[model samples]
Target: MELQQMRYVVAVAETNSFTRAAELCLVVQSALSQQIARLERELGARLFERTSRRVRLTPAGAAFLATARQCLQAADRAVAEVAAAVGEVRGRLAVGLISTVAAVDIPGALREFHQVHPSVRISLRGTASEELVEQVREGTIDVAFLGLPTTARPEGVHARELAHDRHVAVVAPDHPLAGERAVGLRRLAAETFVDLPAGTAGRMQTDQAFAAAGLDRDVAFEVTNADLLARMVREGLGAAMLPSAYVPQLTGVVTIEVTDAPARVEYVIWSRSGPTPAAAAFLALLGIPAS
Candidate 1:
């Protein structure tokens, strides 16, 4: 019935352990358990099936979980709106981004945002661009930075274009194409490549470009991390096509311009419903006007 009890239920359900949820909620395990017990008694149903090995939500708990989260989000937004009205920005800011984000200096921007609004709590998640867009739409993430093909745009969210760049061929220093000032996709397609996993936005750009050019290439390795992809390229596992802006940060690899390279666009996206005050402040920092 109480907000705190609902919070306890939500925390326990998410963590799947009373002990871990207690740690996250900054409450003693006994206290959190006792509160949830009280809540269950009041609700006249058991919310969780607790076993020594694991905790699972009961049917009733599953039904309650979504509403509990919405209530909590609403409460937090109410408090944040009140603070905003008083010229204060205080709330949680959950930001998501892809690994190949070269358009924005994320850490530097976060540092500056924190310095200006020390009252806000900030968290960052790194994931594939499509997932970031979905998370933004779901409201789980307050804002996101994404890199997608120039032909694509994040759907169901408010997005602002940040930067546009083309992919460059990355090869080991001793590779045959390393010394080339520029190469066309037809030439590069014959070499083995290392790229992001199939179906990801990052991979789709290259895939679509090659498919359009009627060229078929082998991707010998699929990596999720940009740094790991660079390492793979450096060790001569395979060549990689990465954003030109990102290639400058890698060493032990040679970057060659691709005449028919796939173009990528960077964007900052937020919920279409409207940004929270914290998200609004961050967007303002990025020069995006409130909508």
Candidate 2:
């Protein structure tokens, strides 16, 4: 039936009480009852059964409720699409990103986005790659950027490789291996390593590379964020394996390429709800070759 009728039906179904539903719908109980009655009449079915103690949906009402929700959702989406088309783009865009993106590019990108689309609000939340993907699937974010396994692509989300980062080993400048041009995988077998926490994409990739090269190194410490990881490397807590770009020019720390490791690439992923103009514009500035 009509979108308004669907809204009324859903409100009644959720509250399970006409009086409370009407209050939530911001209308009088009598008016809401009239709309529900009209909807049932149009469908030629009895929608809800009422008794002294409580209200319950009839079998027909239960069936109609599912379709009613879909109708209401579609209508709301239509309104949002129309607004975006007119360049009025005046809604919130929620984004989920890995910690490094927020630390590396998000602040600058968001600054530029705000300058051009001041009307569109943004809420940014950062987490590990797996967590960010879950947020996107749950409809908590409009999009995400993270590094994850090429295997197990999530349904209904488009992922694109943005840039490749060579995972490097960071050692203090005065360390024994610092003078070497490149650190071979076998040489690092017995070295004390500092790395990101376990169960992260970075850790998994590191493990895979070490396994591939027949290398096994003892991890001396685990740090969570890029900045801190870099600092710990500088302090000589241990040599670390992390994204090359994240390595800082600490006085004591030097970056050495991993001779046998596969590079970790950053990926841009968006919910299939489709990209908004603001998100697209920011991506353009990043020089992402294609949408």
Candidate 3:
């Protein structure tokens, strides 16, 4: 069967109305129905059960629908790959990032990439590190910048450390420990803290460090955005632990070294297989050496 026939089948299955599917496919209803009929004849299976009330998929059609969609997607991907190989970068690149990212200079890199591959389209999404990792695994995003523990490597993902900055304690400029160059983790254990929610890479690193030190912090607030976390610290809401880059330098918040906290590492993560040409170009823009 032709790819157009598969598209017609998928369109009918998704819309559930031959008339509507025809409209969506930019074809007349009779032509769409004829194509579907021809596909069923070729396969020697009744793909749809017709009734006056609604168009429904038969058992055979139900089973074939998923496979048809996959075939369409694969065909589209193959075409895109060939086009990118012979022409300028001109495909969609879905990119993911954590809200607290301050490393890798994504904006700068995108600016440079745009100059070279103006036809390429970049779609960016910001979320938690865990969600970003999941998106990468599921192929929702082609590549992402994620916060990961120094030694924790996730399965089925290719990751490269893009940048690393020591985790630091941020406090109000007038706080008692603000004058010190560095302070131990235990010193802040008794103080109320503002931090990222649990399971996030930032929070995970802090928790691991505290666990290693046999100390527990009094977390008074949880925030996902680093700017909001910084605001909380500047407002004297609580002390915070964050990567040095995430803390705004010109703001009233003061960043000091946490003597025992490990460095927060930003990794460029992608699926182990099936990277699009746009993704490869984007990675190169991010300065990841070609493998």
Best model per TM-score: 1
TM-score attained by model 1: 0.93
Q: What TM-score do all the candidates reach, one by one?
A: 0.93, 0.67, 0.75
Error of 2 at 288 (Å): 5.0
Which candidate wins on lDDT?
A: 1
Which digits, one per residue and each the tens of the lDDT, describe model 1 over residues 1-291?
Answer: 889998999999989999999999999999999999998999999999998899999999999998898788879989999999999999899999988899899999999999999999999999999999888876789999999998899999999899999999999999998889999999988999999999999999999999999999999899998999999999999999999998888999999999999999999999888999999999899778968
lDDT of 2 by residue, 9-89 (tens): 888889999999999989999999999999899999989999987888999999998777656645655665678788665
Off by over 4 Å in 2: 1-79, 101-104, 149-156, 248-252, 284-291
Q: Which stretches of candidate 3 lie above 4 Å from their native place?
A: 1-73, 248-250
- The lDDT-based order of candidates, best leading, equals 1, 3, 2
Check candidate 3 and list the clashing pairs.
Answer: none
For model 2, where is the 10-residue window of minimal lDDT? 148-157
Error in Å for residue 164 of model 2: 2.2
Which stretches in model 1 have alpha-carbon errors above 4 Å? 41-45
Alpha carbon RMSD to native, model 1: 1.8
Question: How much is 76 displaced in model 1, in angstroms?
Answer: 1.4
When summed lDDT is taken over every stretch of 10 residues in candidate 1, the lowest stretch is 132-141
